[model samples]
Structure formats: structure tokens, C-alpha cells
Target: MTQAQTLDHTSDQSIEHRIGTAVNQNAAHTREGLLERLFGWFFKGLVYAQIWEDPVADMNALQITEQDDLVCIASGGCNVMSYLMAQPASITAVDLSPAHVALNKLKVAAPRYLDQNAFYDLFGHANKDSNIRALDQHVLPHLDQITRAYWNKATWRGQRKQMFARGLYRHGLLGQFLKFAHALCWAGGVKFDKLLTAQSLDDQNAFFDQEIAPLYDSRFVRFLANRRASLFGLGIPPAQYDKLAADTGGDIIAVLRERTRKLFCDFPIHDNYFAWQAANRGYKSDGTGPVPPYLEAQNFETLRACVDRVEVLNQSVTEMLAAQPEGSKSVYVLLDAQDWMNDDQLNDLWHQITRTARPGARVLFRTGGLTDILPGRVEGAILNHWRYDAEASTRATAEDRSAIYGAVHMYRYEGA
Candidate 1:
């Protein structure tokens, strides 16, 4: 290649790396920026083994049609894969985290390459002796080189994909954070077995009040919750952390306790895979509990047939949207990533969302606090093009089974 061509390629790579860095390192010399960097460092690798956002809530809000095209942040890839059951025209999944992008590719590729039982064993059962063979024989060869390298690369324990043979859901940064939370509970002279294993809603609530809720009031727990780094495992950056604390009158522990209560008592244990995952590390081994749509036995054929319509990318959402033609995308799933963006970043994102969005396109996102974030932050010109649906947003938020988020927002583009 010529010298100019090589320089141009190198510069483009540099720009790619810088895309999301500013969101985390905006206040680099300040204490807030330091916490951001710490969270960024911890978040550089695999964070969520499963996306926390509820795909059910997403599909409901999006109201996707076969003519619709989607762009979403592929955290655990669950949302993208599950959306296939709806049979959208295509999905363009992007993530700033390389680890998450790799995970997304592997997830969709496995369904295309592996049979029902093998795919279930690998992801549904999530810890099986046969997964290694399944990966080697069926899934690995079909994945992109980056995805193959990611799963096959050596980690301290072994190759990354071997996690499926062990407890795949119990190894990511979120998983380790959960492990730490459990340990903290043990140290605090309380255990969650009573709360998590309870058979009835009344029993769960009683256990939470009698044993779990009081644990948050302790000085040790309060001190840790106050630290911005403590909730990093939940992928809550320092910026979101501040917002959550502010919303709760500086009582992060109180807010956490409330969310935890909702996760346990709001839904029955047999029905909520999220609660099972939070308390038990993996889904119910007996296959009686619920799971993501893509992980369901009934949806297996649908996924196998439609997995090719999905594409995974390790790029910022704004950057990806900027490259798309105007009015091309119909649905946008921002997740809760906007909780980390500053005013400028939020403006940039809305600009692209408006540019790439069709007149009737829908945008859905979750927030750490109970408010639509775009109102005052995003510039008027860009934000004005979109119309917020308060009624639909409220109904969808209530329907959301995943109790982690404080609010869910939906908006429709009205065009210029």
C-alpha cells in the first residue's frame, strides 16, 4: 500500500478507538473522571453474560414489522437474537465493547451452525460437558475470525469458549460482581438463600424485609454503596452512579435495596430467569423456568432460519448510525448507555438517530433514574424532530419484567 493509504487506515483505526473514550474520560484530571477510568478499565472486558434489559419490553415498545430494520447496542446479544422471532427485515447490532461484540457474533452464529439440543446445552443449560465438542464441530468454523479468536483465545482458566462447559453465566464481570455481593451479604451476617429460594411472593417479601432489607442499612454496606466503583459490575458508570444517588437523596443503599426487592418479590421464581440468574448464577437446570426467546426450544427453528439477517459490530452507536443512509432504520434500542453520555454526546447521538430514522420509527431506551434524559440535554433542533410518547412509555415501563432500570422511554420520529 502507498504511504498515504497506510496513514489513512491507521488514522481511521485511531478514530474508532476514540469513539466512546470521551464518554468515560471527559473529566480525566478530576476525581469523577478517575472513577470513570476505573469503571472503563473494569468494563474493557466481558461485563454482562446476559443483557439485563428485557427483550419482551423492547419488542413491545418497538412494535417491529417485517419491513423494519433495527439498530441496537449488543450487550449480551440476547435482545438481537430474541428479536429474530419477530422476523424483522434486518438487525444491525453494535457495541463499543469488543468483548460484547464477540459475544453477540458467537450467539447468533451458534444457532445457525448448531442443532437445537446442542445450542440449548451451550446457552440454555449454560454448563455442560458436551459444549466443547459442539463448539468445535459446529459453531466455531461458522463464526467470523475475530469471534473465533475471541472464544478460542487463552484466558487464565482456559480458552474463553470453554466457559460454556463450566458456568458461562457465572464468569463475566457482572457475574463476579454478583459473587462479591453474595460474599458481602455473608460477611454482614445475612444470607439470600431464604429470599431467593422462597416459594411464594409473600415468603420472598417476608424474607427480604426480615433478612435482606436491613442488611443495606449497615455501615459497611452503606460505605461500599457510596463508592462509584461498587455498582460498576452492573455496568453503571460513574455518571449514572451519580444520577442514581441524587435521585435517592444520596442513599444509594436504599435505592439498591428497593431494586433488589423488586427483582425478587415482583415476579415468581419459576417465571423470572433474571431473578434465577441473579440469585443462582445460572438458569434453572430442570428447564422449568423461563428464558430469553432465543434460548427457548420453540423458537429454535426461527432463530436458525433468521440468524443471517443479523450483523454484529464493535463500534459506537453514533458512529454506526452516521454511516447509515437517512430514514433507513426503523427501530433503535439505545439500552441504558445514554446514562453515561454528556450533553455533547447525547446531542451527537440524537442527531444521528434523527438522521437515520424513518418518520414513524420508534426509539426505546432505559434510564437509571425516572426521567427521559434527552429533554434538556440534546439540542432543540435534533430533539424536536422526535415526539415522545408518555402514555406508551409508562405502559411499557410497567410491563418490563426486568426491574433493574428506573424508567423506560419510547419516542417516535415525526421528521422535519
Candidate 2:
């Protein structure tokens, strides 16, 4: 069966049905606005190519230990793999999107079965012709029936497995968006490649100031930045757009400029794969530069050994946590998923989180705006069970290499 057919066949399952209901509710909600409905539609079909939030900062916030059991929302599945580097006792990766669930399962399964070079070629190099062969011979045999069916189906570009050959970074919503951005940079006479050659922070800032900063000033670029739809490529829902605009005093252009500056100039390029991917459209080809924690050769064996500890599930975070035994999990990673939710949804989610959290359990998440949404949204009784770590959150937000989010929040459950 084709990709569409597979999706249709699976639409009635609990996870898919729940996600579909949420999408429809968001679209019908009067307060969500037209743009938000559009964003909902876009997100329902979107597959994130890479997770934008910095996992290094996340690790610092969560402070994962061997005794800890983690639950995180799996987006592109990169951070889940990176979290394996922490060697948590286990990780339950929950996502409403089947594509994300499939991707996470693939990541977990690939490292265990494939050899180093083959694994690297499939994900790190991401453009090898042998990737489909590797997937067939090594990866496919190990995937679950659902995940196997998802990847085996034919896509517009050929089989879904062919995405590895074209460069995995060039396939999804974010990937296609970045590709368009590169084309725009070329049209604007900005040499984005110069960023890859910079040896120092000074050189990085200088390059950005000379070649990159000017692109944002163009009328065409500024026009695009002002529109809510233009940001769907970056996984920014309409609610997130509103938060960002409110935070920036409604100057979207200035907000984009500042965020882009931080991405390009605020951090050392050698260690920031986020910057490397932005500039070159993939990771550093030589393998000496920055890559995701899981892709680093030193962590390969560790990830392989620990891969089995992760369980990828297609369900809402609230649903998953409600099904878990109370106090079963020690760490929670909610990656800006709350921005898409309403007050009731937030209350329901936090209720489950608070119930399932062990003593001193830490919940770390990012926000589109700097303001705390839970204070007024969640019930005071449920809210009182958690102590918000403002200082650590501020520090983590400052130290985050991604520089795309407005705030990183850390909450600790007090436990009865």
C-alpha cells in the first residue's frame, strides 16, 4: 500500500483518532483564530526533519541519572537518541504524530542492528546510495510491523527509504523550508557558505554582519517574516506566533533578526551542529565538526546498548502519563507542546504529570514567550505541588545553543 493508504488504514487507531480530534477541535475553536487553524492543518501533516531545541541544554536542566525514568515528546526523534547518551533507566517517547513515532522507532532500532559506517551513512552522512540497501538488509528486518509499514510505503519521491539517499535533512517540512531559505540567500547574493569557514566567534559575527544580516533587511524577506504562514516551516504554530509577537512588541522582523543573529554569531560554530546544518543544509561532511550527541563516534556503543531502554509510543503525553503508575517517571521533557494547548488541556496534562512524577521529579520545557502560562492556567492546588526553578531556567535559556525559543522552564515536583 502507498503512504496515504497506510495512513488512512491506521486513522481509526486510538492514537491517530485522538490526534485527528485535537486537530479538528483546534480548527473549530473560535479563539484559536484562522491562522491557528491553518497551522493545525499544516502540523497534522508535517514531519519534523530535525529537532530545533538544544538537547545539551535540556540534559543540563533535567539532570538525568541512572535511577531516572524519562518521558519526552519525540519530534524528529533526534533528541530521544541524544537522551540515550544520558543512559536513563528508560525513556518513554510520546508523540501524537505517527510519522514522528515511526521516525523515533527507526532511530532506536537502526543503531542496534547496523554497523558503525552503515549507521553513520544512513543518518550522519545521510546521502549515501547504499542507505536503502542498508535499510533493507539491516534496519527493516528489526522494525515493528507498524513502523516497517510506514517506511516501506512509496512516497512522491519514490519509496520513503529513498529520503536517506537525497539527504535526510532535505526531506521534511523544516528541511524543505531550509532549502528554500538557502535559495533565497543565493538570490539575495548572501554567501551563507562563508559561515562554515569561520574559525572564531569574531569571524562568525563578522561573516553574519557582512553577508547574512543584510538579507533580513530586504523588503521581500521582511514581508515574508511578517506573515504567520511563513513560520509554519519552522514548526511555529499560530499560537506560538502570537506569543513571539507579544514578546517582541509585535516586531516580527526584529525578532527574526535577533534570533538569527544568536544562531549564527552567539555560539562557537565548531560545537554547534544547529548552525552547521543551517549554513550547509546538512552536517559537516568531514565528520570532525559538530553532530548530534548520538552521532558522535564515542557515544555510538553506549547508544546501541541503551537503545532498548527507549519505548516510542503514538499517544498524547497526558494519555501516556495517566496510564503509567503513579511516581513511575522522574523526568519530563515537554518541548513547547504546551503552547499548542488550551487552559483545560494544560490542567489535564499537569494533573497527569503531577500524579506520575516521583519525588523531586523535574519537568523541563520550552516556551514561545517568556511569560509563565501555568500560573493562571493550571489549578492552584495542582500548581502548588511543583516549585518553579526560575534561576536555573534563566541560566538554561541563556546557555541554550539553539537560541530559537524565548524561555526554558524547569519545574520540580514537591511530592506528598
Using all chains and alpha carbons, the TM-scores for the candidates as numbered come to: 0.94, 0.94
Error of 2 at 397 (Å): 0.8
* Residue pairs of candidate 2 with colliding backbone atoms: none
After TM-score superposition, the amount by which residue 277's alpha carbon in candidate 2 deviates from its true location, in angstroms, is 1.1
lDDT of 2 at 11: 72
Per-residue accuracy of model 2 over 1-416 as CA lDDT, tens digit each: 99866776677465546754454435455655566656555665545867888888888877888889999999988899999888999999988877788888889999988987788888888988899888999889888777898888887778887888888888777887898999998898888667888889999999889888888889999889888789888988766788888877998877788888999998999889999888888898876889889888898999999999999988889988989998898999999988878888899999999999889799999998888778988999999999999987998898888888888999999876
Candidate 1 vs. true structure, TM-score? 0.94
The lDDT, on a scale of 0 to 1, for candidate 2 is 0.85
Error of 2 at 49 (Å): 2.0
